[model samples]
Target: MFSADTEQWARDTFHHSELGDRRRSKRLVQLASSLANHLGQSLVQSLKSPADIEAAYRFTRNQAIDPQAIAEAGFAATVENTKHYECLLALEDTTSLEFSHSTVRGDMGHTTSNNYSRGMFAHSVLLFAPHEQHVVGLIEQERWTRNIKDYGKSQNHAKRPYLEKESYKCERASRAMETRLGEGMSKIISVCDREADLIEYLAYKTSNQQRFVVRSMQSRCILESEDKLYQYSASLTDAGMRTVQVRQKGGRKARRAVCEVRYAPITVKVPSNKKGEPVELYYVGCQEREQEKGLNWHILTSEPVRSKEEAERILDYYEKRWLIEEFHKAWKSGGTQVENLRMQSKENLERMVVILAFIAVRLHQLRYLGLNKEEAEKQSCEMILSPQSWKILWSKQEKRKPPKKAPSLYWAYINLGKLAGWYDSKRNGRVGWERLWEGWFILQTILEGYLLAKSLDL
Candidate 1:
């Protein structure tokens, strides 16, 4: 819990956001806190009472709770937090908000998969403090419903400027991060997955002196090598080895993977139309030497990768990029279920979705704090939660009176994991964002009740 009520925390978090009227801002904060409390419930189910439902609708209809304003507030907080870190890692990615089979489908755009699927594409950058692996905040978010008519133009993308292409989302996100982060930071490395390997984006990053580690999806041409990018990387000597913890997915068992590390400096050839000189960068490859389907990572970075330690650092940052993907899961199915909303107004839905994004980030950061027991034990739950909230959570989790001193944030999450059905003896390791926030939703209700009782002095 923070120093104030959770609703007050919401207001303070969005303090730089302009929502037209002070009353409107207050209502937005209240609504956000209420929604986070009832994360599993629908709008009507969460509101419950007629008066509460009416208030929620009134706030939604106010026309002042702009989605851009909500995102701007998050961006401001991200910038503020960056001041504390000399080096930060920002993970950039995109996910679709599918609202298929809905009556308001026409308002939403077509997803990449099928014409029938309708939704908006959410492209965002999630900032992180790499030292502690803590999610610092959300840097910026851009949402756009694709125009079906222009979808064909994507086929002829080579003729068009990079800005006109759909792939520009990567560049847009990176630029926004640089502009927002400003100057004075020792390092700000933007990490992205395969889809972000664009010549233009790489050039922009190099010109601006911004650091990045983008997973290479293209078998591009490397300077002084007849072989393609992937082939050339394969020819490099194995620099060293690192044991990476690979999370289970797609029927794979969770295990510590021994990855063969390789690194080399490469001059990436630029596309003719872009009119830029060849860009000099490093290529780092990480792969398990002998699995049927080996865990492989081919990364392109602006930073030097001369040593084994540096190559590991590059791979480490790319691994952190998976956190944002987990973030998208937490944003959607895990916590908000943003696609479940039946709101007819796309504008209002966007605004509400942005609010849920903030909540998702908070849940993510808290859950990650529990990863390192020594580090987590040093963190006070009270600093992160309100005293009333923690007291109620402790009471329910311990099945006894509240403790005089606040429990470590790690213990709070451990109790939360139990509440959410996570077994301590499970070999899969720590509980994920899903179970963490699921338990948090139940805890929020207890917090609400405690706040109400204190107000009434009953």
Candidate 2:
């Protein structure tokens, strides 16, 4: 369906291109084609040679666009489209590629004179929903000033570009929030790890401003005792910990003891040790979650956890960040043949990831979303169900009634697997939309047959 409007969309995001621009003059499409192929591929390793422009070009044709500039144009369009639908939210940071390889070719993706090769430093952010499940944003690096250490100048003009670091979080997030504001999105919350604190989140808060649920970095921004200066660590490892007993459920004896910990606040100077110039603020880690076999350290928001209920809710939804990881896995399941394409530049690769991530996520959401069902026709989401679904679900819901504990989502997955006939497959883990549809149909059939049997008996 997106194919039908491909031409019009391309035109809106271009320059130096007339309808007569050789059908391949748009630089953005060339790049976006690289991205789309990457999205369609199973994994980064299996991407066919980048020299195989024929295949990439062919895919672009199917989607109805010029291959050469697809990546750039597509990214712009997806960002705009997401704003059109109010899907923007906080995005996760980039997963460093080739950072561990100790490569000699250290110029490509180094830390701007940090002499990091980090050969082929590509791949950027994957935007997602309010839950950060599916990607709704993609920010790639094109002007990374490694050897030169310059992010270029920004001017208010049609062709103005962002400084390299500006693309990180603050600037990109500001753009996203503004876009959503125009689209009328309410309750936007930006979540991130320690790296995002430098971005001016508080300044961007709209009267209906987006709230930051970002974790704090231990640095120049962090404060210590008497508001004194102390370098904070990224996590609880440096938080000075203690262990105390707490409640545990489902034990031989109720309220089994577990370890509790505390950490006082501190400050961390950024650039690690740059005197007189502060780059980060740390809140310090305060607690440790100890286990019998191992241990895991944790940190809370730099700001206070005002209400326990809100704190619990934050913890609950934060887990949703994992969904994007699984989404990336599924997206690349075929092989990152696209990654191997070796786009003209690393920027192309980053652009491709964001564009594809957005499409992959959109496809996922469409399945559960109703096309035209009125509010009343649908169940209350957690409790709402189709009449057919209700009949099958009600019995099991009744079986575990009263004193029985509520079932976790595990039951939903298990039942769907059985209903979809996925129980026999070796890769019986994730049931795709096809299988979900098969399960729903099967459930509907079973309910009908049982209802018929009862009527005859009566």
| lDDT of candidates 1 onward, in order | 0.79, 0.39
lDDT of 1 at 247: 83
lDDT of 1: 0.79
Q: Summarize candidate 2's per-residue lDDT along 189-274 as a digit string, tens digits.
A: 45565555542343333223445455544333433433322223333343133332322223633222233333443333333332
Query: Over the full model, what C-alpha lDDT does candidate 2 score relative to the true structure?
Result: 0.39
lDDT (tens digit, per residue) of candidate 1 on 1-458:
22225566576667777777877766777777777667656768777578878888877666756789878886886788778787788888999998854666878878875777788989888888888566888888899898877665566777887788778888787777767766733368889888889888888888878899999988888785989888887889988888888887669887888888999999999866567888899999988987868788889998898999999888888888778987888788876787887776778778777888887777667667777678888988775667877787787778899888888877886877777787867764487666777787777767667778889996
Candidate 2: segments with Cα more than 4 A from true spot: 1-88, 97-127, 130-173, 176-186, 199-210, 219-286, 291-305, 327-335, 342-428, 431-458
User: Each candidate: how many clashes?
Assistant: 5, 45
lDDT of 2 at 51: 52
| Candidate 2 C-alpha error for residue 119, in Å | 4.5
lDDT of model 2 at residue 419?
67
